[model samples]
Target: MGCAHGKCCNRDSSTSDEHSGHHQRGIRPYKNKDGLTQRSLELVHVPSHNFTLQYSSLTQHGYYPDTTDRENQDSFCIKTQIQGNPNVHFFGVFDGHGQYGAHCSNFVKDKLVEILSSDPTLLDDPLKAYNSAFLATNSELRDSEIDDALSGTTAITVLVVGDTLYVANVGDSRAVIAVKDGDRILAEDLSVDQTPFRKDEYDRVKLFGARVLSVDQVEGLKDPDIQHWGDEESHGGDPPRLWVPNGMYPGTAFTRSVGDSTAEKIGVIAVPEISIVRLTPSHLFFVVASDGVFEFLSSQTVVNMATAKVSYTLDFNACLLQNNATAYKDPSDACTAIAGDSYKRWLELENRTDDITIIIVQIKGLSNQSVVGTTDSEVHSRPCQTGGSMNQSAAIVPPLMHQKPLESVGHSSCSFLSLYIYIYLSHLFFIHCATRLVDLPYTWFLCFATCVIFFIVVPAYIQPLGEESSYYLCFLMIFFSK
Candidate 1:
């Protein structure tokens, strides 16, 4: 594990300006007691005034002793006006897991952007370049002395050139955009989570004789069924993951990643899912974060939280303008505020937090003048209105609040009570006529059909009501069926 910082450590970083030179010199290289050359790096602070692009990034370590070690396995980099290309802006977030996870993430953070920059095809075909860079980086890691048999990293990158935004992802790290549609803010996921749970990933892995197991499946295995490291029983409530047949040599959660040579044999790949989006004026901001922030929050939750931060900053700026205040803050403050909120929410969800990283890209304006002038009122008023496609006069569906648990307001108490009574009556009927019911010609079929109707079919049909409501319905179905 290594220390977590917001920026990258470049051994050969060129100083283009006075600040770059100062930044380079301020980073002093050191060696640990183990005598390994530690990569000394500083978080690249892109102040709102001087930054070439509109983006902000933050990384925080997980809970307690994990926080104490500061071995944040997440890393990100933002490069604007890359290689004399003024329109090109690149942003990435990498999440690494395993013993030397930090090294893997750090290596990708350092080299991936360089590879992308150097590729001649980047300007001509950005998607191909992004893919090539990721594969090349994976090969580089495999050939290197780093032990990647059980270790690897997940990456999600955003490359915005001109009006086109290209998002490429490998593993569970995520990317999303806050789209202003009318008066509601909508979260459009730009990158998919490449884990075994996905239908495509599951099918592909199974084709290679690999099995995706749930936490319960792994814990339930006996001697011949499976062999795993750590406790034979479940330690913590682990999630569903990819595992090797009859072995748990590399129990990677994700179906796609970089530099897991051993897991590659079982169909784990380094290929990334790439998406291209044409930016519009209605597009509010872009958010890229590791699973740490997402694990405890939904995409909409993140967008709302960030939108709130943007609103707060807008209000603060308005007051500052009124007073003609000398001291001002960068728009990046919105990103820092979101990260702080994420950490607080994580604490509420779980006892231990994973490493958290968030990057916010302001899309409406690239320069300070336009961004600072943009107020909260404009952004908040239209959450669902897209550039030219969507209607403006549509009734606003209130933005999903992330701060608290959701309750179903659409369902009335009377309806719930009636439904409960109906279920109770069915249960009583089933119990009273069990013997007679079994003698009927299609008795087994009837029972199976009824169970499916009450359990699977009904829940799926009413899922639009809300998740909490669906969950309660499922509980009732189970109770009545029993």
Candidate 2:
């Protein structure tokens, strides 16, 4: 348990001299030779582009009950203005595993983004650049003196180019976007986890001669032939792991990662699962975090936490009124809340927590843009496709734009027209009643009640319900009340 790689090696728990404690700040405040800030953690405001992105990140060292002193294997990077392009930005979270996992994570954190930024076709063809950059970085890591035979890091990165987002992921770290559908905010997964739980990944590794089994089966404590694990959430006490057919030297839970030479032979490649999303006003913000945060929490839970409303008091003539506004919270506060929640959950469940890192980016002021390329439904419905080998044209994935809130199913033009007709008929009926009814005040009261129900109660309820059926119900209520 003292070893970072656990059963992979017998080495003692000795922290790296270069990365002792959590001193390595991924977003350092140093300037490069060209006088550009290499990385930053402060608020970023890009005026040239239509949108303004403010981001905050937090990384906490985990509690290791077995070891007195252990270095945090998590690392992250947030670089802005890639290649001097203000509209282009980068954010990544790296969760390292194994003895030298810290070193692998730090090394990849610096080199992978650098290689992608240096590529000339990054803007024109991002998918190809991502494929090349990840593979290149993996090669560099293998050649380096960092003994990544059984050690490596999972990478989840997002590159913002203008209004489009290029999310590339390896391993289980995840990225999720908060999409505002009417009054409700929905969570959308930007990247899929590459693990044995995924049948495609499990099959791919098995084809590469990997013996996928839990430690129980490997130790003869359980049946080796039967597959026990279902999903990550219900994997019980032991999850399925990948190991060599003849040996249990390298047992990696994830299917793809950077470094992990020993595991690479068994199908753990560094090729990233790239996703493209076009930023819209409805895309409020996105969260990129390590598996430590997502291991116990779902993407929807993370998004909900990040976008949770905070109530504040407003003084009006000394009368304190509670205001529960859904305005976006400060990115810094959001990061802290998310990390704290993940930390609490881990300790509550496992007694020890894995290193947790989170990056919350708030997107604002995105001008409505036309659907340029691949629609989100089309891309999301399609199976996960690995990059590289494809031609430049095939590799270039167009931006996936979100459908307008009003244009969604059930809330269409026809629905609005029907609603308008109902309102008009209701008003006419109220007028006819006004002339016939002997009690004019009662008729007026009824009209006022109808207005309040249709305008205030109906919208308030429908916004949270976020369904077309609710709109129709509101129309019916107004018609019957009249």
Candidate number of the best lDDT: 2
Deviating ranges (above 4 Å) for candidate 1? 1-52, 64-70, 221-237, 309-331, 366-482
- Each prediction's whole-model lDDT (CA): 0.57, 0.67
Over 363-435, each residue of candidate 2 has an lDDT whose tens digit, in order, gives 8776674322322231111111111011011123465334321121222223455556545655665565556
lDDT score at residue 453, model 1, on the 0-100 scale:
63
TM, every model: 0.59, 0.68
Per-residue alpha-carbon lDDT of candidate 1 for residues 1-482, written as tens digits (9 for 90 to 100): 11111111111111111111111212332111111111112122122212333455666655543334334556666665455444456788777776556556666766787788778777666767889999999998877655666667889888765555688899888898766654456678887787655777778987977766655565665332442324212223344566678775566777889877878988889998887775555566778888877776667667766664233233221111123221113435656666677778767855656667777776544342211111122111111100000002111122223311111123222346544554565466455445557878988777777666654566455645655565575466556555
TM-score of 1: 0.59
Query: What is the lDDT, from 0 to 100, of the residue 335 in candidate 1?
Result: 61
Residue 422: error of model 2 in Å? Answer: 39
lDDT value for candidate 2?
0.67
